[model samples]
Target: MNDDLRRAVRQVLPGVRTDLDALVRIPSVSAAPGSVEQVRRSAEMTARLFKDAGAPDVEILDDIEDGLPAVLARYPAPPGQPTVLLYAHHDVQPAGSPGQWSSPPFEPTERDGRLYGRGAADDKAGIAAHLAALRAYSGRPPVGVTVLVEGEEEIGSPNLGTFLARHKDKLDADVIVLADADNLTTGTPCLTTALRGMAACVVELRALEGGVHSGSYGGGVPDALTALCRLLATLHDEQGNVAVEGLATAVPPGAPVSEAGFRAEAGLLEGVQLLGSGSIAERIWAKPAATVLGIDAPPVATASPTLTPVARAKVGLRVAPGDDALKARKALAGHLRHHTPWGLQVTVVEAEVAQPFVIDARGPAFDAARRAYGEAYGNDVVDIGSGGSIPFVAEFADAYPQAAILIASAGADADSRAHGADESLNLADFERACLAETLLLAELTRSG
Candidate 1:
């Protein structure tokens, strides 16, 4: 059956490739204003693919309030078989600057076997892989398939949890497959079981009320920019760990990262020793990491030569699992407010808080996925965790607690440059993922 499924998927690769190209050509960036038309078009394309793959109810479900469209597709299960819900996003992050791309960001260009575009790696390819797997099995897939391709994931999936809560029964499934992730590295089949929580805060520091002449008040007046620099500097101690008080930390249970592997994949230069680590996995996945994202000050090239009155910075706190994002933000904010030098006033506005995700992997669905991946990749499988937080993961967990969740990402590599320029996914990896999904469905139906 696995071999037959593989052959079928191989046969369907050309169609998958064409569909992926067409989807990528649509500028489906949901976060940008005036991008609704493109997002709707992408959702329509996904629905068409679902219909082509034999989904019974492949409809573009649009939110009247949000105006974003989601593809809700369903295929009936044979008697005594269970339903599987496949979740992925049709929306993608904004393609920042065209100058940064090797080719036009919207144009799907294949170079050296890699397909490159804004949404190619992040999610659209995952959707294509799901379509390919479903097409291979003529959409029956040995188990019922209900797919929810969201259009607002890049903007934090604000409506997903609400939608899930409202339509719980409609989305009931025995297993849920989330394809927004990738492997631990090339050639490894990884199941991500944990995700670090995230907290975002914008810290604004003020001093001396307003800007003054640099030469006249340089030494006398307190410069807001200097105060901000000092405050941001204190976010991390000398060893480069977040110094915020009351931030909860935990050690995630999983495979530890090797030094050689980290060094090679992270591209760490010489003389730059990686900071604050027991293990790379611990530092990234379990421990808290703080970053000062953006500071609202003049550019170095456009210096005003004045003592700035206000300096604002956006700070990001990557918290470990089970850590409360709201608590972390409060703690960091309190620390900043109290630690401001010389009575400088500091205001920290809460930007966003996303709770972490941890999936229990001891279940029949996971066992089936392990078997499917092993068969597809011809390798042993490893369970891993991520430091990045997906805001909707916890919501999915809550909405589908009975459903076994599986994370089979195509670019789950440590060096997979997601959210960065030059991000690419291997075509072979994509094919393997599709075959694995097909096998997983077969295994799940057999389990019943």
Candidate 2:
């Protein structure tokens, strides 16, 4: 079986590059118009690969509502074997301002052993990895397999929770292979065990009726922009810690981010002091992170604004895995509403919220992943937590409590630029992930 799988994988290896490049060329940006049709085409292409790999039933379900089409394929369980739900997304983030790219963002190119193109790394490569894994099993994997390829994960998976809830029984599995994350660093297999929850709100304050002459009304009329700025200012203390009274929480011990790594990843300038005191892991995973995403005001180019009547700022709050998004949103809204310096009325618009996810570390699934990665890489898997939230992971965990959810992704290479102008993935790392997936499936089959 191993030899057969190996040969099948090798046969598919040369085509992986071709498949990824072909898909990347489609410009399937889910957020843009005419992109949904491209996304649907990609789904159809993906479904065909699964059918060729050995799936017995493959179907594409279009929007029962406002959702990108989801592709599901089922491979029945071999006697006494366990099923693995393979999850991936087909849609890609808009390749913002393609002019910023070294090459055309849609043209997959290889430089210094890295494939570069929009969606090449962020997730198209992930989709390729899933196809490669299925090819390795030759469609008749040792374990049962069902794939849930979502089309709108980049937009926070607004419709997936409902889809999962409706199809919960059909999707039950012993393990969930969420092939959407990356290793901690290149070649170092990373096992993501936790993700921070996220919630966003825009605080708008209106003090005056409309813009008034700055010189004339500067003293008598309260500046709405000033009041909004003050309200935003109160959100963080002098040292940059979130001063929102009830939002912050304690961080866990694992998933440490060294100061050096943080600086490098965040592109911190020299001589700049790092704000907030705590372990990098704690600061990112277990604690709350607040950011004033954007301010709504006249641009500097359009100067000479009279006393502005209204000003608003979009705020993003990242809560710990245990922090409640709704409660946090309410607390933040109330704080802003109560803390306005002047008598300006405040309006807070709740943008979006996603519950955090914490994978239980002590489980057979974790052990199998550790061992599979160890066998493939000759090293222990590193534990890490993501600051960004993938809501579907939380929803999946909620729906299938018994399943061991594992994220084996190839995202660590700097060359694997996801969401950037030119994104790519390491061919070697992708192959390693495919091998690991194969081993994991075999391990799960034997474990039961």
Clashes of each: 7, 3
Which candidate comes out best when scored by lDDT?
A: 1
Query: What TM-score, over all chains together, does every model reach?
Result: 0.95, 0.94
| lDDT, candidate 1, 1-448, per-residue tens | 7778889989998998899889888989888888888998899889998998888887787745775888889988888889998888899888887898888888888787677888888888779878988999876678888998888888777777677766777789888888888687677788888888888888888787678899998888889899988888888878888889898878676777888888877778987878785788888888888988788997899888899888899988887887888888788888888788867878878887788877889878888888888988888888888888777678878776787888777543555566766566677788788888888888887676
What TM-score, to 2 decimals, does candidate 1 have? 0.95
Residue 67 alpha-carbon offset, candidate 2, angstroms: 1.3
lDDT of 2 by residue, 1-448 (tens): 6556556667887876688788888777778877878888888887787777678899887746867887898988899999989888888889889788888888989887788888887777777777787777767778888888888888888887778877778799989888888666677788888788888898899887778899987988898888888888888878777787777574463645667866786667999987776677777767788899899898889868488888989999887887788888888888888898889988888888888877777677778888887766667788888777888888888888888888768543544557776677777777777777777888887677
Question: Which stretches in model 2 have alpha-carbon errors above 4 Å?
Answer: 1-7, 248-250, 253-255, 413-417
For model 1, the run of ten residues with the poorest summed lDDT: 410-419
TM-score of 2: 0.94
Name the runs in model 1 displaced over 4 angstroms: 267-270
